[model samples]
Every structure is written in C-alpha cells, then in structure tokens.
Target: MNQGDKWTYFLGCYPLYSHDADDNRMFRIITSQLIDAGLCRQIEILNTFGVSKSSVARSLRKYRADGIEAFFQPRKTRKGGRVLTEDVLTKAQTLLDQGFTSGNVADELHVKRDTLRKAINDGRLSTKALPPEYTTKSCRTTIDAEAAKNMGTACTRPEERIVAAFGVCDGAPVRFEPCIDIPKGGVLCALPVLLMNGLLNGAERFFGTLSGYYRTFHIIILVAFMALCRIKTVEQLRGHAPGEFGKLLGLDRIPEVRCLRSKLRELGSDADIIKQWSAYLSKYWMDQDPQAAGTLYVDGHVRVYHGGLTKLPRKFVSRQRLCLRGTNDFWVNDATGRPFFVVDKTVNPGMLAVLEQDIVPRLLKDVPNQAYDKDLIADPFLSRFVMVFDREGYSPQFFKKMWKEHRISCITYHKFPDDAWPEEWFKEQKVTMPSGEVVTMQLAEMGSFIGHKKSGLWVREVRKLTNSRHQTSLVSTAYDMEYQKLASCMFSRWCQENFFGYMMHHFAIDLLAEYGTEQLPAGEEVVNPAWRQLVRERSSLQNKHRYRKVKFAELTLSEPDANDENAYNVWFSLKSSLLEELEHYEHELEGVKERIKSTPKHIAWEELSEEDQFQRLSPGRKQLMDTIRMIAYRAETAMAGLMKGPTIDTPAARRILQDLFITEADILPDTNAKILTVRVHKASRPAVNRALSLLFKRLNNSEVIYPGTDMQIFYELGGEGHPQNAGKGVTQTSPK
Candidate 1:
C-alpha cells in the first residue's frame, strides 16, 4: 500500500498493522484501512489496490465488528525440557575445580550426558585455552546406584522398587519338637507379661506374617526374651547357643543373628504399621487399667551414634556428660513405669519441641476429654490430663499454649524460684512413689502464675523440704487432686528417667538400629554456618576494638603537655600513634559491617552445607527396634509391679525378677489338656524365692499361652518346698 509519498517499510510479521493479516481474502481490507486512515477515499482505494468498492465496504464492516484479535493466529511457547539451572552449572564447575573430568562431573551433577557434551560444544561449560574436559582426567562416567534405583526403565513396576537385601542367609525357622529344653533367658517367666500386654496379638495385627516357619508371634517372643538376657545386638546370638534359645520358641534352633537382623529390617520396612501397633498396645494397657492414664511422665533420651562416621547433630548425653552425635527419642510412660509410646525426634529436636508438636497433641487427640475425671468434661469444659516432665519443659508459652489449646496440663519442676520455703510451711506427710513405695517427706503448698502474665494461670506449687535445707518445688495444674498425690506425681517424673536408664543398660535402648540416611525436606530452614562464623568474627573484632580503646584512654588519661621540648615531642608522637591505632580499628569495624550485610541469616536445607542436610539417619528402623525394646521392658516392669509391698522393695523386686528371668525351667506340654507347664527352679536367696513363688502364682493366674503353640502356660516350683538346686535345671515330663 502507498501513502502518496515515497515511504520505505520493512514488512515481516507486521507490528504496526495488527488488525489485518494475509487471510483477509483481498487488498480490499487494506484499501478499507487506507480510507479509514484518510490515506485515500473508499472508491479511490478500490482503484488504487485494484479491488471492488463493495468488497472494501464489507471488509470495513468486518473490521468494525471483529476488531484486531480476530485477525491473529494463537501464540504459543515450548515448556518443560532441560533445566539449565545455576546450581547445576555451579556444581559442575566445582567438580571441575576439584579435578573431576567433564563426564564425571556431568554424571555427579545428574546433568544429561548429551547436555554436558552440548555445553562443551557450545562453549557453555568450557573455554578454549583450558577446556573443562581437557583440564581434568579422561575418566569414564558411571551412574550412581542410588540415582539408578530411584529412576527406572519402562519395564520396572512400582511394587518392584525395593530390591531385596542380601546378607549371610540363615535357615528357615523350625521347631525342635517337644521335650527339647532351651534356657532362652528362661522366657517362660515373661510369658504372662507378653500375654498380659498383647505382644503376641499385637505383632500379628501390626507385623502380619513371615514366609518361614517363624510367625509374627515367634519373632516378638524371641526378641523380648533376648532382651531379658541382655542380648542387645543380634550379633550377641553368635556367642549364645542358638539351640538353647530355639527351645524357648518351640523350635529346633533359634533364628541366628542374621535371621533376627533380617526380621528387624523387615519390620522397619513396615514402620508405619508397627507405630500404629505400638499405639494399639499402649491403648490396651490403659484400657485394662484406667488409672494408668491418670498422669504420665515424659522425657527425651539420647542414644549416641558411636559406630558410624556420620556428621549427625550433637545432643547432650546426660550419662556421658558430653555432647555426642546421636538421635533424640522422646518417651512417654505411665505413673508406674509402664511405657505408653515413644516418637523418634528424627532431626534431634529437643524434648520440649517434640512434646508440644507431637506427644502432647497425640495424647490429647487419643484420649477422651476429662479422661481422668469424666464428670468434669460434661459441663462443656474438659479436664486436663497431667504430664510430668523435668524443668526442661518449663516455658511459660509452652505451658500456657498446651492448656489453652489442648486442655493438657504439665507438671515440670519450678524453674529458678526466688527462695526456698520457710520451715513452718513444711509438714511431714507420706508420699507414695510411682513404684508403690511410700516415703515420708516434709511438704508445703503455695500458688503461683506460670507462663506469660496475660496467658498464664495461678496453679498449686508443692515444695518438698529436706533436712539439709534443700528444697524442691513441683508445679501442678491439677488443682483438685490431693496435695500428696500431686507431689507424688511430680516426684514420680524420676520413674520415667529411671525407665530410660534401665532400658539403656538392659535392652540396649541407646543402640542405633541403622546407619542409613536420606535427604531432608528442601524447605526446612536452618541457620547458615557461614553466617554464624561471620557473626562471631564480627563480635571478636568488636571486642578487640573495645580493648584498644581502653588502652588508648589509659595512656592519655594522666599525661599533660610537657614544658620541656623533648617531653612535648614524646607526648605528641605517642598521641598520634594512638589516634592511628583507633583509625585502624574503626576501618576493620566498617569492613565487618559490610560483610555481615551480605551473609544470609537463614537458608533452606538445600542451601545448607552438604553434611548438615543429610548426616542423620531416618528414624524408621530405630523406631521399630525401639518399639520391640519397649515391649520387652514393659514385660519386665509388669513382673516388677506385681512384686510390690513389704516383702520386696523396688531394687529387691528387680533382683527377684532377674533371678526368675534367668532361672532354668522344665517345659511340659499336654496336648489333651491344652496346657504348657513351666516348672521353674528356685532362687538361692530365701527372700527372693518367696517373692518368686508369689510372682509365679500371679503369672499362673493369667494362664498365658506359649506363642505359636497356643497352649496355656502353667508355672510351678520345680523343687517343691526345697530351695536347693531349684533353678539349676528341670526335666520336661510327659503329661499322662
């Protein structure tokens, strides 16, 4: 089209003439636009472009109705191909700097092999004088096993993802037949405890079955029994006679160390189910006895990872009195040392974190409102369930938040009270420990607000005054509970700590089950180590500046200008030197201020130092093993609970249980009567023997069945009234 003057126009995909295109059918459209712009008349336009006047009018009608959008084809762009990210490039460059070949760096960074080849070909990854490939060795590239395992071919199925792990394969589980005697840490004593706690039934529900002769019930029995014998590591089975433990399982041989480890790993794979099962078992415990749910003790136990070279986060190990790389596990136990459940702090978050975020919320969700006092909840206000922990959980925000949000109460020791109670406030009263032992303590009561002033409340505080003027205060939210009982609950927090100590020594509760790790979530925020270093360096520089300032003042404070020329010159030189030093210090401070501005305060886990992101193992397997150990400890505790009263104190009862658990017993199975008789050998100590007899009578009343055998277990003293050689040995008698 011409505009009456000689106009030069470059037309490709037209930018200015957007409302018209090649699909307009003729130049009539262009002619109409020309007339609309007063470049020409409608009839003159028809003549100029060699088109009809009616067509020009019609084109004008279309332009007025449809507008510019109707003339253009849809625009599009390509997406989701290769991602040439800065991170990938930086990593590749770093690898090259570290002497890795181009191919090796490409493989390491998971960049496509061809992408790296193209990068070198296009000069994106290499320069001419010192190309990335030429600067490094010509090493062959290899795929990462972990990476290969994650991504697979079209033939791979989702179900076939986990390749079966291979180790020294032990034989399948098989029974040794009847009459074969195995000491097995005398697992017979633990029979009632298992049956009482639903370990056998629980395993079936949670773990299901194994293909071998050993069922879910068999593994549960074996692990608990092994724990009783202090056989912590499965490798310990190497020293023990497998056949001896086999007899306990009604098998020809106990599953060897390999098989046992395999079983635990298998359980770990189904960690979710086992976790649910643990909850199920704990609920059963509380259901059997409602009082067990009254007030629970919560604490975190550190299990140091001594075997691995992992750079896991450090936790304070109380017993070791040092910070060590380990996992932090929070455990919940009832008043009498019975385990409720434990959750692994996979990131080693402290007890208070786990309590508020996980344990307390879970407890509140699981229990009915006013579980301790049902009537209190009927008025549309729920009664709080008490949790007794140490002073570590004594944050005002934590206490107030738990109460207001979840209606959960906490009884941690008072942190940093101003003064001890007066002597007159102390009154002698008997307080029963969680173990059922009653002790006389001088007690006092008062009230104080906890947490922040706006969100906190006035709660009862109990003080236990000692003979040496030492006083311990316990803060409680259970205002209506008896003062003595509340004091006992507060003091009973030790029972949970003791429970941790006992498990560590007996069941290897502190042992790390696996040394495998996975990458943490990318969004998890952590302090940048580089930033922290910068901060500390700044502080150090500031301290040095302060010292120099003080020194400069000290030199200048008493000196006056000397009347003598030599003295005046000396003073002037010294003052000038001091001023120069001050200037030097000020320059350093300014540089530090600039450096701090560039440093990041926090970064996502992905941006963390490589070691910090994945130095800790996943808690799945540790959790599985932990649950097994909890059941074992629970069994032992059940026996201990029954041995209470004047005859046996807690320590004495423990000794009795130890003897009973280790004693040899005769196995007698009556097919017709559906009974399995365990005639236990007596203890050397007469008092223990008496306690043993009483414990056996109680266990026999439970009439627990042998796992896998389904035969009711009956306990009896092998030597009748005589304590001589009672626990040494017993013969399996055939029932008539």
Candidate 2:
C-alpha cells in the first residue's frame, strides 16, 4: 500500500475511527477485497447463505472477527512451487531426494532456464530435501545404488544407535563418562560450615534476628562471594549452564543473566537501601541473644587516595561518617567478635559531630541504660571518663571534661617528663608485671587540669620502669594496677585494628575502584569540551550570571538539611509530640500567682522572648519541647546504633559471621523437615522478604533464625536426636 493509503487503512481500525472520510474509503476497499475471496463465500455457507436472520448475524460476526487481512490473504506456500512436465518434476524430485541441487536439475534437464524455474515456483513442487545452497549451485552428485544401500544399512549400526542415544549427531565416536567421585570433606566447604555453626548457637544467632534489609545485605554478600569464587563475568552469569549452578545452590531453576545484572546495577545506585540494610544487619548481629549483653567497640580509620577522582557528595556519606572522620569508626560487640557499625570519612568538624551526635546516640539506644555499667572501649580520639588514647589522641583536658560530665570511667596510658608530676606524690612506689617482674616507680598524680579547675577530681598516674632495651616513664588512669594482665583490654584494641584492615582490604577496594576511573573512551572528553563551549555563548550575560550564581549557591550550601522534610516524617512527628509534652511539664510552676504578679516588666519581656512567639504560643510549650527533644534524641540514638557504613567495619567481621553461619547442605543428611536454600540474585528488601517466605515454606517451620549454625547439626543428625545433639555441644563445620 502507498504511505497515505496505509495511514488511511490504519486509522479505520478501532480507537482511530474518528479520522477523516479517506480512512473509511480505504476500509471499504479492503472489505470489498475480502468479499471477492472465497473466505466471504465460506462464511455465508457456514451461516446457511445468510438467509436466516440469526445466520446473517453469525456471518457478519465471523467476518468482523477474522478481520480484512485474514479473509483476503492467500495460504502461505512452502519453499518450492508446482512442477510443470513429468520429466522436469521427476528430475527435481530425484535430485532433492538424493541431496542434489535444484540448479543442477535445471542444468541436467537442458531446457530453457525459466522452464524449471516456473515448475519450482508452482505449488506442486517441494524443496524439503534440498540444502540451503542448492538453489545457487549447479553441480549435482549422481547417486550410486550400491553406496545408497550401504548407507541405509549403516544408519542402523549399533555404534550409530549409541551415538544417537548420547545426543551426538556428528559421526565422531563417543567417549565414556568418567566414574571418579571427589570427597566432600575438603576445606572448600569447611569454612561456611564452621560459620554456620557459630551463627546458630555460639554467640550471634543471626538467622533468628535477620531483618528485611539485613536479609538483602546477606544476599549482596552472597552475590559478591559468587562473583569472587564462582562466576567471574557478567556474560557468564547471563548464559550460565543451569545444571552447573543449579547443582551448587540446589535450585530447580537458575536465574537469567539479565536478572543478576539488573540487581547489581540497582544496588550500585541505591545508597538508601544499602544504608538501611547495613543498619538492619548491625542490629541483627547485636541483638542475636538477650542473655549476651555485648560490648561495642568504636574507633576510626582513614582511607587514603590520590587526588585525581572527584569525591561523592557529602549527603551520600553514611550518617555515621558525617559525625566522625580521619580515623575510621566502627561499633563492634566484643562478646560475639562481630563488628556491626562502621563509617569512614575525611578528617573534618562535621564528621566529628556525626560521631558524637549521630553514631553514639544510636549505639547507646541499643545498649540498655544499665549498659553504661560496662565501659565503652575506644582510642583516645573518643573522649570518655574511661578514655583510652594512643600517642595521637593524648589530651589532658579531654579526660578532665569526661570526668566532669560523669560520662565514663576511663583508663589511659601516657609518658612525659618527671617534672610533670608533683614532688610529694612522686615518692617511691612499685609495680609488678604478670611475669612476676617488679619495677620501682614514681607516679605524677594531678588534682585538676585546666578545664576542671573547680571539680578537682581529675588525676594522672605515672611510673618509671627500667629494662635492658629502654628505661622510661609510664603514665595511666589505672594508677598502681599491674601492667601485663591488662592484655585482654589491649587485645580488644587489636580487634579494632583488624576491623580497619578489613575495610581497606575488602569492601572499600571495589567502592574506590568504581569512583576513581572514567569508564568512557578518551575521545569523549575532547568532544565534551567542544559541546560545552558551543552552549556557553548561547545565553544572555545576565541570565548566565544568574545561573552561575544559583549553581554556586547550591554547591556551597549543599550539605544534608538539618530537618529533611522528606525523611520518615511519622517518626519525626512522634518525636516532636514527645518534646512538646516535656516542654509542658517544664513550664508548670507551683503557686504561679505570686511570681506572675511580682515579676518585673523586663523579666516578663524576657519570658516572652524565651517563648516561641514567632509561632502561636501553647500553654504546655515548655514541657512539649522537652519531651519531644528527649524522644527524638533517643530515637536518633537507636537508629544510629543500628547503622554501620562500609568504611567503619572490616570485611573480616562479616567474613567471620558468614563463615560461622552460612553452609552448604549437599554433604549433610536429609530429614523430614524441609531444608530450604534460596539463592537471591538481587539483594533488596523485596528480594529478602521473598527469600525468607520461601525458606519458611520449604522448611515447614514458623521461625527461621539466622546465623544459626546449629541448624546444620539438626539437618545432619536428623529426627529426635537432632536437638539432643545440639545440647551435647557439636563442633561447627567451617564454611567453604
């Protein structure tokens, strides 16, 4: 059809019937062509020649249902057409049957070229036996009768039958299948088994406490493991053989490559989900068991880099990192050897605020109010009553402030000149090491430092020790306490260092890689500059200046908003209400009549200023503000406790948890209780919930606790003996 005619015809279809008269005319012509064909006749015949009113209606219904193209279109023909003369037909059939060319038949017939072509073009002829190139080649193989007979016999040969059974159509001989079986007790599976056992009952019962986001986090880690240890390329993930990975995960079906790629791309862009998942997992690790009141270790570390790459926007940094920088910070539970919260940032004032105002509050919320009884361990960077500072964090004023605030009971070690202490307190004293070695010492004790001049409770302890390697002075908050036995606290510090190592060596490696490089071709840079220059001169000077000013304004003040309107507002409102209640209580005064009447005009004016006059003042305003502030602070602290960024915690802690909890089921014995294993290609809230549901259904169990390595033992031992075996203290298998 011509373009206009086609358009007209197209418009005549449903939803476009309102088009001009030209479209209706095209539709009529198309319908007329359908009527001319036998399709209309067949419809009329089926409806008894449309004589009966019902029959006419049926015929019309059939006509409309079939559409114009279906009624008028000819039947589709096969490759070759009809044969003309018997001889030409015979020749074509013989060649095709014997695997010869159609062109060969045309040449052998020695007739006008169009004669064979016409026969082939007709519907009577078939070219099913011809190869794809038969129409182009003139050469034909003459069949040998004896050879054809032999070939027919060869098709039935036992070897050929065996080849067919194996699905090998080619003529090559088949090789025997290998019978070797590898033992399953190798190191490859041990690590995951061990991790699973630890996760179930040892300390962190991760499975039982897993949240939606935490589940997603685990899935992401699983994907990372797969990428690192199983399949390496995106293409491989897409086109992977189902049998191979299916056997590994015990899956009935394998995910497509597109699904995995889509998941990875989604996770890369979704920082919010990552943050939520990180927090959820941290909480899960911390609250694994109620009996275990875990000690959380907080510290900071640096992620150094060359200055070529642009940094991520400040808002993208985790809330934990926004408070603390320079030194990486993490919250580790010493009881479980699990690092839950971590953050990394450059050294800056904003980062420090995040640590004190954000991270600490959240962590403390997870910790019961009574948890203050247990000292929070940190380097000198974190100033607490019981502060531990290395050479870099040494500050006398910091200790004094902590003492005044009654925030902590601390132990810090220092070294300085003898004159730093008072002469009377420097009298002979002795300290003993765990190895039974004794050293005479003089301690320089301090009553008060600069900031705590009035309180006078701050004290410094100093000692002099002589050794073959070096003779020097030692200082500490743990005055005359023995030195060597404090190794447990020292070892705790080592765990923090290990966490730092993991962040740098594992998680940060990939993140830094993604940010540091330009993925586009070098030529694109040259083209980009030209395009920018071309657009630069198009606008008016005033407009350009205004745009520049606006852009600069955005960049300079682009930090995360103090009160983000779009954040979880329900929680915010709840906090605001609580503050309002607290303010109401604070403003309540007994016998207010006298104070109100006797108050001076200036004092009354000051009271009015203190009131929120900009907004309509409420009677309970003071109590309300107090309550809301307290609630908001508590909630913020709770959330902060759960949040852990990739920068703070090392991959080692995650690795240890994974090793203690996750394991393969192939080597274990089967049981009536279904063993559910889900391989989520994508890690996210939805994926995690779906996986949990599937696992729950498959196991026929109500609750599926995570990091539950004990499940492996139950799975292995089977039946009533399973729970008993756990009671007997079974050793955990290491994860592969």
Relative to the unseen true structure, what is the C-alpha lDDT of residue 603 in candidate 1, on a scale of 0 to 100?
Answer: 75
Tell me the whole-model lDDT of each prediction, alpha carbons only.
0.66, 0.35
**Which has the greatest lDDT?**
1
Tens digit of per-residue lDDT, candidate 2, span 321-415: 55221223333334223355545332223433444555655655554332233443333322232223333434455444444343543343453
Q: Each prediction's TM-score against the native?
A: 0.66, 0.36
What is candidate 2's TM-score against the reference? 0.36
lDDT of 1 by residue, 296-411 (tens): 78888877786564666667888889988776778888887778888775465557878877887677756533445445556333446788889888877777677666567778
How does candidate 1 fare on TM-score? 0.66
Regions of candidate 1 where Cα sits further than 4 Å from its true position: 1-181, 368-382, 419-421, 450-456, 521-523, 538-602, 721-736
